[model samples]
Target: MALEQLSEVIQRCQALPENSYTSEDYDLFTVAGRTCIEEGNSLQLLSIVLDEKNQEIVQCMGWNLLPPLVQVLLKKENKDLPHCLAVFNHLIEVCRPKELLIGLLEQLEHDDPDTTAESLHVLLTPLQKLLNLGVRKASSLGMALSSVLEQLCKLPVPETTEQEQDDVFSLGQCCSELSAFIQPFVEEAQHNHIRGKDSAQMMGDLPHNEDELRTELLKCMQVLSRLLLGVQLRDMDTLPESPLRDFASSILIGDSLPALVHRPLLRHRHIPGFLEEEVRYPKESLACIAHLLFVHHLLADMFPTVYQELYEKTLVRVEDCGLPVDLLEIKSFLSVPQNLVKVMTICPHQNLRSKGLKVFQLSIDKFNTEAKYKFFLMLKTSNHSGVEGYIIKNIKNQIDSALKAEGGNVWFEGLHLLPLLRSVLMLPDGPETDLLQYMDIMESLNLLRYLVIRDKTGIWTELYKIEDTFLKPLRVGINMSRAHYERELLITKEDKKTKAKVSVGDEKLPNMTTDTHIKALHSALHTFDMIESVLVRIEELVD
Candidate 1:
């Protein structure tokens, strides 16, 4: 009955003139097609559509027939898989790419895991085909590509052995497909933007206008960079193999761009624009790339040049114009943790550094446990005392949470946690260390104090090593800093009194107030006092 109904609909649809099918006819056709699909006669249903005599019927079915056919493709053991692929491929050739993409994307979004997985397995090839068509046809396909890629980026990464084993459509496969899809854009970009080829001479259909093509390329780069970021967050271990990484490397670190050469000095106003296009990539894209490089430690040679360029640009922005009102809100600026560290540690402008620190703290708080662990591992060797100290504070939070956790936190337990703690606890200069200079030492002292008081057995066994390396050096350093600050405080007071007496006759001369130097000395003294207090408590706990 379903096959007969489908045949009648097909005949009626074919007999009518093109653009002559009414809404009722499409509804009837949809019902017949879905019924035949449900009744296991999909091959019979598609055989007619696939016939050369019924080409108009195929066009008439248009995108409306996609749903039933997609249902067939997604079925696990459908006997009509070959016919379904043929019909779907035919639709790809004749139907509007946009409608086909939209329909398929909706099917991919099905809530059931099995269905979504099946859709990915079946639709990935067709989607790639559509992408090729869209690119070659010079269609307004960038918008659709962006939506689809962004959705794919959000696909949950398999984290556990079981989840990975169970994954029917893994992120790795999706990334591979996306990487292939991005290749044409990369080639066209290199050809047109870098090689100076005319758009007409380029392969496939792309926008003729150079700027339009550039805009599309940037969008692709941005999303691909974001996909790389997702790979980093889920499993940094897999990032080396990620096809996304390869494309990013080709664009950002390729020979076309002077990734290794030092950028010459430019006027402050031009810095923004220059960095935005340092290598034909926009600033946000560069930030994502820099972030990937920083995490991988792959930029010991090339990345420093880019960092220098950014430092020079940021210095100008902070000194000449001051921090922007939306500086913290800027994704490019906040994307890289190391960039924030640079701002907080070395930027000459105090206000900008302060804002940078605020954003840094907020950003650190936003990462999940696994990301935080990976981030901390990458940043612990930053060589900046304050940054390392800030990282130690976060590590302390993780350890504390793990101690109190009922089941234990995977990231904050076992051998990995021990090494991280040891790194944070070590003082390179030992007893002669300048506690005032290295905030990390102070944070380390606090973390040590907490561990001694909390984990008597786990961390206690390492106490001898901690005492020799961390506690002893910290003790000597704290005493040195305390004595130094106290003496400086006294000298400043004496100098202030002397200056006041001398300036009595010179009313025009400013009196000695608590100036910047005095305020800094007082703050140092307070820090020393806090360190001493924490040290004493730690000794009491350990003894």
Candidate 2:
């Protein structure tokens, strides 16, 4: 069904002429790319573009409207994969530097060869291509590029006035600067991959990987296309590669424009990464399952899928995971625990996968004598892993649940898992870590709230320590984030002398904006204040 629907859309996109598809259809294409998998065509269009590109249906289609489709498709890493390959294929088909040079040769041998001026314009075609390619694969291609520029610089230095000599040298100097400018990109590519919370993870960019290098070649194509915006490839090829080649032999021959040879090269900008992946949140975590008794089993019968895995399959515990603070409360459903607390957990009512990763940390050693007998049963019932930290966490949760249960005769929802709270707060974290799940903090603070209420005298000291140790570091992180964004906030200044301009959008930087960073900083600070306020209330109640 999905395949047929997608085929129909492709037929429509291809069957109709370019003018036939309206701007409304363009908007639908964007929506279809984002929602087809969820609502309409079930990703039928993406499959046609990927697996069936050679078919007659799309082969005749002129890809004029491809840019907008590409913009929406590149929002995530996985979604952008097919487009990445397509762009790579396009670049491979169009860029022929060797061919460009050969055409330059034809011009040098023409009957009325005006070698200098016309040949230099033709030379720009391949020079720009090489520059863009060097930007993409600078680490390995840098030396070869520097070598090419050196060859171009070998032209005879006319012993005329200094100004003429300066013109010739300027072109060589720009090429040399461009050659050395790719160092920053090479360094960034080598830094660790960002395993973001979003599903659209970045495609791996290993500089040494030949396959990755091939796809990345597309980055240069955009810049090259911009420079050659309206020029015809056939027309450029009619010119010659020679006058440049002949001039490079350290000899100044007759019948060539030395003036054109000395013309400054066109300055091209570096290709911006429009397809970089979105970052994920809450990097580290542990998963543990909740056990069910008779009443729980009965509830499970009502919504078998939801209750069966109520706390079974999808259980994740990280420092923080909630959305921005101003949204007020976590958009989750309330579920009761045993008698010690009323609301034990708040699980996702829909899209349980957003709860992040589903992991198995159950182990025989962690499951005490009470749960020890159920070891074989657990192995059969749940997906299990021997990951030591997760296993240790699982065992601690089991013990915490059992301890909470011993104090009451109610069925356990594993809500009063004290050890889980301690492990989360007392757990060692990186100095600048901010990717915490809000639920974790809420749960930990909730447990403290319950503790202080039940055993006020005994719990205050522990609560203070937890606040100092856990919440303090979080406060520090929030402040640092605020300070950082404050610097990022763009400040517009006016000058009386010349009226200087400072754009809010700095072309050199990406994801650096006053509003976005400020909002995030404000969000972090808000979450911190809420946590601190709760801690203060709990402390006062204990006192």
Candidate 1 lDDT over residue span 373-401, tens digit each: 76788789888887887889889988888
Estimate candidate 1's RMSD in Å: 22.4
Worst 10 residues of 2 by lDDT: 280-289
Q: Give lDDT tens digits, candidate 2, residues 312-384.
A: 3222222222222222222331111111011112222222222212322211332234333233222222222
Residue 266 shift from truth in candidate 1, angstroms: 20
Check candidate 1 and list the clashing pairs: 136-205
lDDT of each: 0.64, 0.36
Error of 1 at 248 (Å): 4.2
Name the top lDDT candidate.
Answer: 1
